[model samples]
Target: MKIAVIVQDGFEAFGLGVLTEVWNEPYHPEDDNPVFDFVVCTPRPGRVKGPAYDLFVDHGLEATEDADMVAVTAKRDIASPSPEVAEALRTASARGAQIFSSCSGAFILGEAGLLDGRECTTHWRYAERLQAAFPLAKVNPDVLYVDDGNILTGAGSAGGIDASLYLMRRLYGAKTAATAARRIVVPPRRDGGQQQFVRTPLGQTEADTLAPLLQWASERLDEQLSVERLAAEAHMSPRTFARRFRDETGTTPLQWLTSQRLALAEELLENSTLPVEQIATRVGFANAAAFRHHFAATRGSSPQAYRKTFSCCEEETAEQAV
Candidate 1:
């Protein structure tokens, strides 16, 4: 694949590093791994001062025209992108080339009109501004990245890594992406969303206040817990507790409990040789059927399939026996 990383003055170093790690780093080349023709392109093509260092790019804006993917690295400035760079990005998009942006680079994509009506994301800090600046864009603040067809927008630093791997997975396959991830010592896939990192001081304070109650709930995922019971434990009325839970966790109490239970179920499925029925009961599901239904709905695979794919006790499964 021909990939062009568009850089500018004050470019973010970590974002570029992620691109290099995924596309440029050599690993198991003899195993028929995908090779990318990666190039760093800038508007001026000479010495450009980034946040960390002044580097020389050999190519200019025109290089993007021939690339299968044009990636815009984040800039510290987050100022309006130069017309020349914006034009190059728009041209690449018009020609069906995949367009990508890391962190604040989504602002540049916004300038190119590529994010119009598209669900996109940026760093949590910039999500509100990105939405205000590009009113037509649906800016989802709680995701690591947004893959809206040809245009992919990543959130903060690590989000760029996830976005790049996602593109690789989409273009190649999970196994191929896993090879690249393994080479870098990163998980082939990460669970949960970026909601885990959002910084809300008020939320944090509320969470701290409810910490003991939450810990108690976490330990009893096997129990069919209710909001009323949790509320009583917190010494607050049910309505007040429900509202506080949403304010603090960004999700309803039920949703949070379900997530906790599902997470435990995944752990047990991967590590234990227990039957599905037992695992379901251990994770607070009403029955094996309900567990199977929710597991498939949330994980896109049955518990048995998940175990087959990730079971640590390999010798205990039917496949291993066979």
Candidate 2:
């Protein structure tokens, strides 16, 4: 595949680094994977300064002329997208190339009118600005990325990795993307709407008071875990523990606990042959009715339905083992 990554002055170094690392890294020859021909392109085809360093590009915007996919790296300056860069992007899109952007690169795509009337996402900090600037574009700040067929936009920073892995999944397959993610030490798939890092005043060490308590609670989900018990586990007053927990996790203790329980319930549903009532009991839910309600609320599906869909693969594997 011919992949062209567009770079420019003030472009984010980390976002571009993620792209280059994924596309440029040569796989082990014994693996028999197809080689991806990757090139860095600039508007002027010369020296371009990124956020952290300078790089010289051998190809100009013309490099995208024959490319199958064109990825725009994030820019530090989202307020203004250069006219030349906008035109190049529009031209690339017009040529039927799959267009993608990371972080604030959505602004460039918006300026080029490619993102008009399309669902997209940018950094949460810039979601309001992007929506105001491009009213026609549907800006979803909650998502890590949005793939609207030909044009894909990633939220921010690590979201670039998510978007790139999604592309890899589309071009290759889930196993291939998973392998690449293992090589790079990143999760293969983070659902698009997963929340980004929350802004908080507490530093890591100061805020991590409830880590052990959380781990303990996760292990004992089948047991009742109330505020008093959680506080005791953390060796703090209930009020203090609740306050500190919210500060560090950006969510209330109960909310976090509910999410963890839901996750555990999901795994149990997918991997076990136990009935809904049994799974509910194992995951600490009071009954099958309560588990069904919370599972639907958090996962957008009934417990039985989720199990039915996800368990198929496991069922196949079990049969193959037999």
Candidate 3:
């Protein structure tokens, strides 16, 4: 597919780099992947510089005219998007090309009037400004990204990675996205909202060691795990452990534990015939009432509701197999 990446002065280099690496990189020879042609476009054709040191691009805005998708990179300045650039985006969107943005790039889409009445996200730091500017748009600050079919927006820097990977999953499949994630050594999918990371400090020294503990906890969600017990397992005092855990991860221990338990409950709801009370016990909730409360709070629906909504398709597939 032909993809056009919009660029301009003072654009975030890493955001642009992530898109380029994912869509423009040569695929492994064994897979015979289709070529994804990426073109860098700017308002003016030649020698446009970015916010990063000594990085300049040499493509004009006209490059987007024929693209199948337009990916807008965030700019250091969000106050003014050139009329020409905005018009180009409008025209592309009108013609049915998929539009996407990372971080402040959502501002450009807003400028083009593409974000009106749509659910979207941007870097949390800028979400207020974006919402204030485009009063018609629904801004969700807690998500890693918002995928509204043809138009998508990511929350922040690393969220750009998540947004792009999700795009790959939608276009290709789970297997292709998994392959891409394996190459980068990041998880194929994250379990919770980016809010889990907000307001928490990361521990520098203990960061790498937490991955194993997280995996172990995920597998044993049925057991009661107090902060004291978890701290003991990590070989640290509770206060020190909490601080380090928050530092290493961007969330509190209880918040992380709740997220994992909910995830496990979701899986059981979709894949098994276990009663709500049994599933609640399996995931360490004291009773079905507690499970229902937490699950509804996190997932916006009760266990039976979630199962009723998600189980139909899976059952259909199973019946087809039979």
The candidate maximizing TM-score is: 2
- Which residue pairs come into collision in candidate 1? none
lDDT of 2 by residue, 1-322 (tens): 8999988888898988998877787968645455688989898878888656888888888888888889998888788667887887788788788898988999989999988889999999899999999999999997788888699899887898998887886677555676688878997776565666554545667666667778889899999999999898888999988888877776787777777787777667666777789988998889989989988876678987776556635575456558
lDDT of each: 0.84, 0.82, 0.81
The stretch of ten residues in a row with the least summed lDDT in candidate 2 is 193-202
**Comparing candidate 1 with candidate 2, which one achieves the higher TM-score?**
2
Error of 3 at 31 (Å): 3.9
TM-score of each candidate structure, all chains considered together: 0.70, 0.74, 0.73
Q: Write the per-residue lDDT of candidate 3 for residues 224-320, one digit (tens) a residue.
A: 8999988888888999989978877777899889887886787677667777899999999999999999998876778988776555245654565
Q: What does candidate 1's lDDT look like per residue over 1-322, in tens digits?
A: 8999999998899999999999996546556668889999999989989766889888998889899999999998887557888899999999999999979999999998999999899998899999999999999988888888799988888888888887886687655776788888896654435363533365456657777888999999889799999999999999999887776767778878877887788778777888899999999989999899988987779998877776667567765557
Residue 262 local lDDT, model 2: 79
Residue 68 lDDT (model 1): 97
Give the C-alpha miss distance for residue 134 in model 2, angstroms.
1.5
CA-RMSD of model 2? 4.4
lDDT of 3: 0.81
Ranked by lDDT, the better of candidates 2 and 3 is: 2
